[model samples]
Target: MEQSHQALSSKSEAFIEKENKYGAHNYHPLPVVLEKGEGVYVWDVDGKKYYDFLSAYSAVNQGHCHPKIVGAMVKQAQTLTLTSRAFYNDQLGPYEEFVTEYFGFDKVLPMNTGAEAVETALKICRKWAYEVKGIPENQAQIIVCENNFHGRTTTIISFSNDENARKSFGPFTAGFIKIPYDDIEALENALKSTNNIAGFLVEPIQGEAGVYVPADGYLAKAKALCEQYNALFIADEVQTGIARTGKLLAVHHENVQPDILILGKAISGGVYPVSAVLANNAVMNVIKPGQHGSTFGGNPVAAAVAIAALEVVRDENLSQNAAYLGVVLRTGLNEIASRNPLITLVRGKGLLNAIVINCDEDSDLAWDICMKFSEYGLLAKPTHGNKIRLAPPLVITETQIHECLGIIERALNDFR
Candidate 1:
């Protein structure tokens, strides 16, 4: 349906109220109640057109409701949706072959969401450390970064420093160490400090912590340190993978390949819940049958959707577009920051970008700015209290991006 130039009416308010009434208040969503999305745009129930600056947290890099991906999904769903890993399904084998080859991995294990895939990779790493690296069972330690947002899973939250995610959630799980991100010295110290180190799991670019792009060569150096210490270099590319950072994987920026790669979000173009963990024989073979499995993982419909989603990335040359547009976006945002005192900083790679508001982290100024942005026909979210992430779909055209930049500039001006 085409977007009509209307305000959020009682219709939108009703939906929000209904959700607040019944649903768990786990998420603090922007007040805009999205009802429909197409390309890089979303519409509320009242049919107001707004540029989708978030891209469902970079899941719709292929763009929302893409026809090719949806078509593949529909065809598969009509034929066979699930047969379980107990019985082979036609789509699973082909998808495994396609995705493994596409990402240049020797093998792939599928799961349904980002957190599940992360858990799966952790299992593979610890098992590899015990069975192969000869670490005593239950003593293997995985290194994570401070301010990393892997997921809400209990095991992941064990190593996290985020108070909101960790508050009252534990007695958290152990066997993990947290380190400062983008610090090569910290990584090396952690690695050399212990013999029972299983792996170093990290995001190529920390997306949730306000799109914090690490220093150049951090990933490469970290991976090399892991190799030197005989530990796995696991890259959690769930948010930064699949051409989101102008490379198929953010580590590609430094020509580093991970020992274990975890992916989700855009893997299925955000049309379905699909995640994958890719590794070579040495690491992956550690997990035997019944050691780990997901009933919904590798289902036929997911297989079909993932294959199509990946194809769209290649066919559209999204990596190149993102690379070029990233330069344009950062340049533009930098210019805006120069003129707008409200915007203290702008930083990111490709479409995954953020602007720091000139306020304390505890201040709600960033949230208030987002409300003004919504009024001006753009949708973005504040992270870390005083930073707003601006990752739109990679499929956005230069013209549309400039238009959105105008909206952003105007929104910043309003704050002045």
Candidate 2:
């Protein structure tokens, strides 16, 4: 059995080689072939271990292969997995109730990916504009932020200002107004001037845009403005929600509740693809039957998995854990940044943090630092070019955090 396992590992490497040779060149990942993962760590195909600082882009916030989440998945799979919305399932209602209550929403529309959730929100906003807000059809506008990384769908990418994401993806979807992030004035100006606006969609913290956190009170003021204008406030917390940002949701930091909440990634604790669009009945009921849905959306297995995943966050107090350790990790990084000229800035909240490299966006400096981090047994990824996002699982312990910090410090010194 041991020899057969070794042969399987060798075959996996060969498969990876074939993938690089044949697959689309869309993603330029680091040269590490991960084979297995546990809490806060992953082992490469070569049996080398590394701390997982990226946390699967904050998908594995409950840590990799959490036994509870996986166990739920196993039990459900053995019993029942998929029952499309065409028929009622036993798991969907209970899971919906659990998730809606967890996030303080009245209803939830399930989807399979972050982009689908964003797309769902957009559709809901537009429908609500016409039906609820009495806006003319095809004239409802949604406000977005500059440098926002919502998702990669055609309609979602249409509002993206990133050239790589937007180039040649036209003629784009209309009805979106773009504003600078962290600037309340721009949002206020847009909101004041626009009458047919349906909603304001934003990432509380721009995760894929290198973890750009908005200014203090930005969300609070923005939600207020949306209320004043009678427009829906849609928050794309797909990357920052489910306790990734110390709070159950990032908007909680400002005591703001969005009208429409988009959640994904860690909602399944990295066990499955489960995303949801949450809102009150007023906004959600705008979409009657046959308006929007996915074949796999709200499947029995996804519902079951998401309920267990969210329960873990509450039971384990992962939000409080992230809050405490985030300060420690950011402080450590900031201290290191002060001493290193190569590191221009270190900024983030909770477990979602990033270090900006003092080099060109296209430079390999960030990649070099990541490789060095791997050598020191910590794994992370570079977003954009010269920025590396450090988002460990919220389940990580303080001792593990310090150990990871030691690895990061060594990587910084070694890179120098």
Q: For candidate 1, lDDT tens digit of each residue in 1-416? A: 11223355788889989999999999998778888999999988778889999988889999999999999999999999988899988899999999999989899999999999999999999999999999998999999999999999999988988888889988888899899999999999999898999999999999989999898888888988998999999999999999999998899999999999999999999999999999998889988899999999999999999999999999999999998998899999899888888888889998889999999999878888888788889999999999999999999999988898999998778667
**Candidate 2 overall Cα lDDT vs. reference?**
0.90
Tens-digit per-residue lDDT, 1-416, candidate 2: 00101123575568678878999887877667888999898998778888899998899999999999999999999998887889999999999898888888899999999999999999999999998889998999999999999888899888997899788877888889999999989998999886998999999999888889888999999999999999999999999998998999999999999999999999999999999999999889888899898999999899989999999999999999999999999998888888777789988999999999988999877888887787768889999899999999888898998898888877777656
What lDDT, from 0 to 1, does candidate 1 have?
Answer: 0.91
Candidate 2 local Cα displacement, residue 50, angstroms: 0.8
TM accuracy, model 2: 0.96
The alpha-carbon lDDT assigned to residue 242 of candidate 1 equals 91
CA-RMSD of model 1: 3.1
RMSD, every candidate, angstroms: 3.1, 4.4
Q: Deviation in angstroms for 216 in model 2?
A: 0.6
Q: Clashes in model 1: which pairs? A: none
